[model samples]
Target: MSEKSTVPGQFTLVLHSHLPWLAHHGRWPVGEEWLYQSWAATYLPVAKVLRNLAAEGRSHLLSLGITPVLAAQLDDPHCLSGMHHWLGNWKLRADEASMAGNTALGAHEHRLATEALDDFETRWRHGSSPVWRELIDAEAIELLGGPLAHPFQPLLDERLRTYQLHEGLADAQHRVGHTPAGIWAPECGFTPGMEKNYDAAGISHFMCDGPALRGDTSLGRPVWDSDTVVFGRDLHVSYRVWSPKSGYPGQPYYRDFHHYDHASGLKPARVTGKTVAGPDKAPYDPELAAAAIERDVADFVATVRERLFSESERIGRPALVVAAFDTELFGHWWHEGPQWLDQVLRALPEAGVTVGTLADARDRGYVGERVELADSSWGSGKDWRVWAGDQVADLVDLNTDIVRLALDTLDKMRADQDGLRDPVADQLLRETILTISSDWAFMVSKDSAAGYARDRAHEHAHAVREIASAISGGQLAKAQRLAAGWAAADGLFPALDARRLGPALGGNDESGGGSLRNHAGPRGRRMDAEGPR
Candidate 1:
């Protein structure tokens, strides 16, 4: 009997692409560089992979969640232009190395640099590629939407959160030319009552980690709360491709993530093993890594085929095995991830293991009804500890205090008719929303770029406090001073409306001192627990 005859089901893949709104915010360690690097390593390459697969007449299923913030950067004329310049600069830097180094090393450096430049230019040429469009059109990809800036849903000022979510959806529709059927919920952060807001906004489904589904680490069905389906990531299958320490990319033969050449500030080494560190690392060999990709892809395909058959037989239906991961993991961290992706897509069809997107699987009746959902995330241990850990304890406190102060200020401004048109109020609202951006806490927790994280968190906090003090003390002169500074900062959520937050804070008082606990239901109740996802 054929393997297809033995296996009873299909599998789905969902990839979420999210980065905080970093344009014009911070640049060096954590801000724009993060976006640019991901764009080069993961976004552009993955888009190319999808386009290539579709061209070969392979209709594989993949769900991609591109946050509104990231979309803005991608579509921004300045970012596009800057990206082009950056790639060109990279080529120049590589050339400089080629001229300075020994013949063999110089030649290798020159070749790799040329390849990088060629790939980037070819894919991003003319400021357009139907790569994203082609996948959407072919129905091979499903788009997941999120807020304008990825603020933590439960921690945000309720009205601002609603506006961010609504506007984010609208923005995505405008940019991509389609309203998404689901949302990626920032970091898959979901609260008990957020569903009502999602429902009002016309979102039909969303995704969360497996732990969110009754604490079980398996593929789960949709939750209660208004028929909006929830698809949980199947970590078991996902971890095989990328685990904390045991992922395929960590193999000694892969390109090293750390240990760049200090003088040139370029990566020139391969991961020898867990013990290899810094200056002692061996040279990278793309050729050797390519060989590893074939082996890993074969192993991955067999795992999926086996999973599909096992799940199908167990469930007595075509069960789906969803493998989800951060888009940055590919090409950026793994280096060989894109190659592995290409091989796996081709291998699945040959093995008769049908690959499909989340939407396709749902349409094929692969959904189940579950009422209870646990509070969870895809962070360490699949929980919220990372964002709320001791390392960022001060940030958590700062966010709480600032949010409270901003809410109070907004409430005061609304209560006084004179404050309605006051530029200070408007500025306060802007600072408040920006301050609550989920990226700050995330960066602090990860320590990936902690210095920038501290600066950003403190900067927003300073704005919030200064504005609040000015408005409260009737120091119009000083408030204006602070407002000028905020304007110079130039945050993205400038048009945030404090009135939208009114209902959430207990009444229409815009001074900002209302309890969200009072507003925790459909109308106002939906406003109670807005925090970062």
Candidate 2:
């Protein structure tokens, strides 16, 4: 009747783009450097690729998850100027390498740095929100928003978790001009009944790991009486290209992320081999890596087609195969990733497999039956061990105490004075959310940046405790001073107001009308730093 829709099944590619608030934290090895590196290497390049495809009339190609915290950084004027400076310095570093006789390496890096600078100055001159809005408006990609500061919602206090989820989506609406219908739950972490929270927040769908669905991730499933659907990552298809033991990026020809030339502060060597030492590794070659990308693209397309075809037959319906990954895995971690992505997206459609966003898949009837998802995450052992296990016990204890103190302080303040604009309380809440971020625990467990992570966690916790004490002691002047200082340092969410925490403190109203303040949800609009901007 309608040509029978020859598409066997739908394949959705989800890339999670996130980074902690890094501006003014530190430079060099960790803090701001991490943000700039990913911004240039991953964010910009991926945006370019998506824009190019959109120019070719590709719509709803994939789902892009951008954390609220990362969005704040992108939109901040401070970070914009800092990122511009970083690019200029990046080109200088490459020139220095060339002067030292590493011309080939320097030339490659210099070209990249130059192009990134030009792109930033041209398209990103205003802010990243406008750039992303263009893509969203074009229907070229579906955007996924997460909680403010990327807190691990399952481990958080229910009240705090709700506050974060609502505020996060609100912030995204503020920036991107449209509330996201879906979210990429931080770390794919979830607990039963969390779907109810998603429902209340106006979220239509979200994602989790395969184990959360008992390994049946062939289709998006409605959970717990909520029409809000949950999609799980299909590891069988995803791991075909990138796994711990082996991945296309780990191949000898791709640029090595770890090994860096000390003088130029740039990575110049290819991965070479698993056991190869940095000093002994071979120089990176662009031509060889380009060839590898094509081969991997072909293999990956075949893998997705086969997985979808087999699952469609077994399940007796059109299935959906979602392969999710960290957005940084492309240009940041895997130097050749963006190019490979470009190839795969183009190849899949030609290979007779449908490529579309998760929303598109659902609209085309790829949803399965309702399910009861277990408490799970996409971490080690397919459980919550990474964020809440014995390895991070101290940090876990700190998060509990910090969230409690901040909520208690805010509730007490509201009891005394209703509808007072308290910057001190607002900043305290900001510090509390930063401390509860899931990154600290994950870093500690993995030992990747344990020291920096632990320090950051404690730093925010200390700030929260100090500001709360100043408020509780009736030292309003002292509290304001302390808050002003912390706001100068860890200030990311400018639209966050202390009154937004009312619902989390046992207030009945979703809109803050019957509560201490009169702030509406992000969808309906909310108060800004200067009041209703």
Best by TM-score: 2
Q: Candidate 1 at residue 264, lDDT?
A: 57
- The predictions' CA RMSDs to the true structure, in order, are 4.8, 7.4
**Each prediction's number of clashing residue pairs:** 32, 0
State the lDDT of candidate 2 residue by residue for 1-533, as single tens digits: 23223658899999999998888888867898899999999999999999999999998889999999999898888899999999999999999999999999999999999999999999997889999999999999999998999887666777777888999999989998989999999998877779999999988889998878987999999987998899999989889877888878898889999999998889999999999999999999999889988888988988888898899998998889999999999999999999998889988888788888988877888888899876677888767678777777777668766776777778778788768777887899899889989999889989988999998999999999999888888898999899999999888888888787744433554322121122222221223346532
The residue-by-residue lDDT of candidate 1 on 201-233, one tens digit each, is 887778888767743323446566576777778
The TM-score of candidate 2 is: 0.93
lDDT of 1: 0.71
State how far residue 242 of model 2 sits from its true place (Å): 1.7
Q: Global lDDT for candidate 2?
A: 0.86
Q: Each model's TM-score, in the order given?
A: 0.86, 0.93
Q: List the candidate 2 regions with Cα displacement exceeding 4 Å.
A: 1-7, 503-533
